[model samples]
Target: MERKRGWDTLLSADTHHNAVGLLAREMRRASSPLYYPIALCLLRLLTREKTSWELPAMAFLVEALDCPDMTEWSDSILEILSRRLWSQCTEMHRLVLRGLVLLSKAPGMADGVRSLTPSLVELLCYTGGELVGMVLSVLINQVQDRDIPISTPTALRLAELLPPLFGYDNIHVQLLSIYLFQKVMELAVDKSKQLLKTHVIYSLLPLFFHWHHENQDVAEASRKALLRAAGLLKRRDLVKLLKTEQPWRFSECLLENDKRRAVEYACQALPYLESPQEPVREAALRFIGIAGRYMRGQRVELQVAINVIEDMTPDSAAVKSLALQTQEILRAVQRPQSSPGSSSLKISSRRCRIGRLLSGAAAGGQRRTYSGNPV
Candidate 1:
C-alpha cells in the first residue's frame, strides 16, 4: 500500500524519469507482489495523452520488456508497441522498434506482432538505414518460418514493397528484404496464390537484375529468390536457365512471355537507371533497349523511357553509349508508320474540321471558333 502510495505520489509530482525507473526496477527485482500493478501502470501510461508521460513511460516499458518469460504480457506489450509505432516521434519509433525486436525474438510472439507487418513493410521505403534494417530484421523473423503462413492481404502488400528494396544501399537490408520476400511468396496462403501471381511476375525482372549484383551474398539471395519466384510463376524455361545461371536470357524471355506489360515493364526499369552500381544501370538500359522493340509505336510510353534515360548524364562511357542507343531505338519505334494512303487521310480529316466549322457558323451566326490551334 505504501509503495503504491509512493509511486502515485511520484507520478503526481512529475518525477518522470526517476519514478518510472524506480518502479521498473522494483518490478524486475520483486516480480512476486509488485509486478502486476507496476507493469500494468506502465502499459496504461502508453495510453495517456500527456506528452510528458510518453518518452519515459515508453522507456520504462521497453526496459521491462527485455526480460524473458513475457508470455503473459506479450499480447498487451505488442499491442501497445504496434499502435505507437505509427507515431511521428523518432525517439518513440526507436523505442518501439527495440521493443518489437526483443519481442520478435521470443518464440510464438511472431503472430502476436504479425499485424504490424504492412506498416513495417512501408517503413522500408524511408530514409534511415538502421531503421530499415530493423524493420527487415523483424520481418525476416516473422515470416521466416515456412509454417507461419502470412495472411493473403499482408503477402500481397509485401510483394509490392519488397521489389524496390532489392537495391537498398545497405547490404544487410538488401539481403534480408530479398530473403523475406522469398519467404512471403513461399508461405503466403495457398488460396490467394493467384491474386499474388502478378506481383510475383513483376518482381522477376528486378530480381533477375539484382542477381547480377556484385555482392555475392546479395547475388546468391537474389538467385534463390528468382528461382522461387520462377517456381511461383511456373516458368520451366526460366527455372532451367536459372539452374545454369544464364540471366542473360531473362530479358528476351520476359519480353516474349509478358508482352502485354512490356510498356509497364520498361517503366519499372526506369528507376534502376539511377542505381549507384554501373552494372545495375547497364542492365536497366539494356533491358530498355529490348523493351522498346515490343513497345513499337507506344509514343508516350516509349518517350517516357527515352526522356528518363536522356535525363541521366552518366559518368560511365558504357552507360552513356547505351542510353543513346536505347533512345535511338525507342525513338525509331516511336515514329509514326508510313503507308500508301495516309497523307490523303490527313487531308480528309482537315476538310472534315473545316466543314464542321462552316456548318456551325451557318447555323448559329453567333457561333465562334479559334484558328489558333497552334501550327
Candidate 2:
C-alpha cells in the first residue's frame, strides 16, 4: 500500500524527474507479481504524458516485463503498446516498437504479437530502415516456425504488403523483404497459393534479372525464387512472358531445361528483331540462330525471320551475320537431299538478290520484294 501511494504521489507531482527515476529503479527491483501493476501504472503515465521522460520510463518497464514465463504480462504490455503505436510522438512510437521487438522474442509470445500484423504492416509504409527491419524481423519469426504458421489471412496480408519493398533504397530492407516473400512462397497453400502466384509473380519478374545487384546473396536469392516460380509455369505462360522486346534475357533461365520449348520460344523472338534497342535485336537474332534447326518445316516462321534479317543495315554486322547464318541453316533443312556445295551456291544467289532489293529500297528505286522461299 505504501509503495502504491509512493507511485501515486510521484505521478501526481508537477515535475516528473522524481517519478521517472523512481519508476526506473523500482522496475529493476520489483518481483514477478509486482510487474503487472507497475506496467499498468507506467502505461497510464505514458498515455497521459507522452513526455520524453515517460518514454524511457515505459522502456524500462518493458524491459522489466519481458520474460517468457510472464505471458499474461507480455500480452497486456503488447496490447497497451499497440495502442501507443499510433501516438504522434515519434520517440514514443519508436520506443514502443522496440518494446514490441523485445517482447516478441520471448517464448510463446509471437501469437500475442501476431495480432499486431495489420498495424505493423501499415507502419512499414512510412518507417525508416531501423524500424522496418525490426518489424520484419518480428514478422519473419511469426511465420517461420512450422508448428505455428501465421494464419492464412495474415500471410495474405503480408503478401499484399511486400511488393513495394522491392523498390526500397535500403539494401537490408530489400533483402529482408525478399526473405519474407520466400517464406510466404514456402508456407502458402490452397487458395492462398493461387493468390501469391497470380498477384506476386508479376512484381517479382524484374528482380529475377537483377544480375548487377551489388549483393550476390540477394541476386542469388532472386534467381532461386524466380526459377522456382518458373517451374510452376506452363509452356504457354513462358511464351507469354517472352513476348516482350527483351525475351532473351530470361529465355536461358525459363526455357533452357526443355529443347522443344526453347525452339518455340525462338519463334516468339521474331517480333523483337525490330526492337530499337540493339541488345534486344541482337539477342533476338542470336536466339533464332540457335533454334534454326527447329524451323525446318516452319515455313511462315522462316519467312518472317528472313524478312527481318534482310531489313538490317550493313552497319549492324553482328545482326546481319547471325541473320545469314540462320538463313543458311533453314536452307539446309529445306533441302536435306542437296549437297552442301549446292546449298551454298543457292544461299549466295539468294543473298545477292536480297542485297539488290535492299539497296534498291534504300535508293528509293523500287519497293522491296520477297521470294517467300525458305531462304
Candidate 3:
C-alpha cells in the first residue's frame, strides 16, 4: 500500500514521464493486487498536462502486456473489474476498461482479453445505456486482435445493446453509438454477411423511427452511419427510411436557422436518395423549394431545381412553369411530355403555340361582330 501511494504521488507531480514509464516497466513483475494501482496510474498519466504523454503511456500498457509473466494476473484483473462493474461509478470503471482495451491491442494480451470477455459482457448487460455506449466505443475502436477477434456472439450482444442507448433517453449515448457503427462498417466491409447476421444492419432503424434527433452532431453522425449501413446491406428498403424522412426534416431544419448548412447537407444527401419513383421525385421537388429559396437563388440551388423539374415535369406548360420557373413565375406547364428531339427547342415552340392560340381567338370574335352588323 505504501508503494502504491508513493507511485500515485509521483504521478501527481507531472514533471516527466520517466517515473510513469519506470512504473509500467515494474508492473510486469508486480503481483495481482498491484494491477489496479498500476492500471489506475497509467490511466491518470494518459490525461497528464502534456498531451504528448498519452501515446507513451498507451505504449507502456501494451508493452507490459507483452511480458510473459502477465498471464497469471489476467484472471485477477477480470475479477476486480467484474466486482466493480455494478458497484463502481461509471467514469472510474470506464477508465480501467479503456486501459484494458489499449492493452488488448498488444499480441501478448490475448489471454488477458479472453479472460475478461465475460466480465465485459456483464458490464454491457447491467450498466446504464451511456455506460454501455462507452464500452461499445472501446470495443469497436481498440479491440483488434485477429487471434482474440470479435466473435459473432459478441457483435450480436453489441447490436442488442445499441437500440436502447440510441433510443431517446440518452443523446450522448446515441451519438457515440453512431460513431461506433460507422467504424464497424469500415472494419467489417468484407464481412458484410457476418455483420448482417449479427443484426448490425437492423440496429439503426430505432435511431431513425424512434428518436427524431435534430441536434446537429447527432444528426450528422446518424446520417453517415445509416448511409454506411445502407451500402453494406445493399437493401433499398433500409435506404428508404432515410430517403423518405431526411429531406422534410432538413427543410424543417432550414426553417429554424442556419439555413446554409441545412441546405448544404440536404444537397449532399439528395443524390443518395434519388430514384425513378414518384415519391422520390415529389420529395426532391419539395426539397428544391425549401433549399432553393433558403439559399435564395444561389447558383447550385437553382441548378438543382432546374434538374429536378427537367426530370419530373408533366406535359402542361403551365404546370411545367409552376415547377420550373424561368424568372417569370407566371408560365405554367401545359404539356405532359416534351419530345427528345424538340426538348432543347421546346421552350420557344411552346411559347409560340400559346401566343398563336390567343391571337386566333381574338380575330374570330371580331369577325362575328362584323357579320352581325352587315345582316
Q: List the candidates' TM-scores in order.
A: 0.72, 0.53, 0.39
Please report the candidate that would top TM-score against the real structure: 1
Candidate 1 matches the true fold with a TM-score of: 0.72
Q: What is residue 230's positional error in candidate 3, in angstroms?
A: 1.5
**Residues 1-375 of candidate 3: C-alpha lDDT, one tens digit per residue:** 245554554556442344554555566457546755565565455434335454345435544543545555555444444444454544445545655665555555556555556566657667764567656655644544342345555555655665455543566766776676555555543444455543653453333322233355665566667666666666554456455544234333433444545455445434422333333333333444444434443555555545645665354443343344322221222233356665657767765654454334323322422222111
What TM-score does model 3 achieve against the real structure?
0.39
Rank ordering of all candidates by lDDT, starting from the highest = 1, 2, 3
Error of 2 at 221 (Å): 2.8
Q: Write the per-residue lDDT of candidate 1 for residues 1-375, one digit (tens) a residue.
A: 245564664655344554665666666776646665556687766655546667778767777775654467777788788787877877678778878888877776876777777788778666376777788788877755536888888888888888878887888888988998889878889976889898898888788778767777887899899999888889888888788765655677878888888999998899888877666676777778778768876889988898898898555765575677667767766777656667987756654553453333222211111121100
Give the top-scoring candidate (lDDT).
1
Off by over 4 Å in 2: 1-53, 65-72, 150-152, 231-375
Q: Rate the local accuracy (lDDT) of all candidates.
A: 0.74, 0.58, 0.48
| lDDT tens digits, residue span 312-373, model 2 | 65536555655666566555544443466577777777656544533332222111111221
In candidate 1, which residue pairs get closer than 3 Å at backbone N, Cα or C atoms, i.e. clash? none
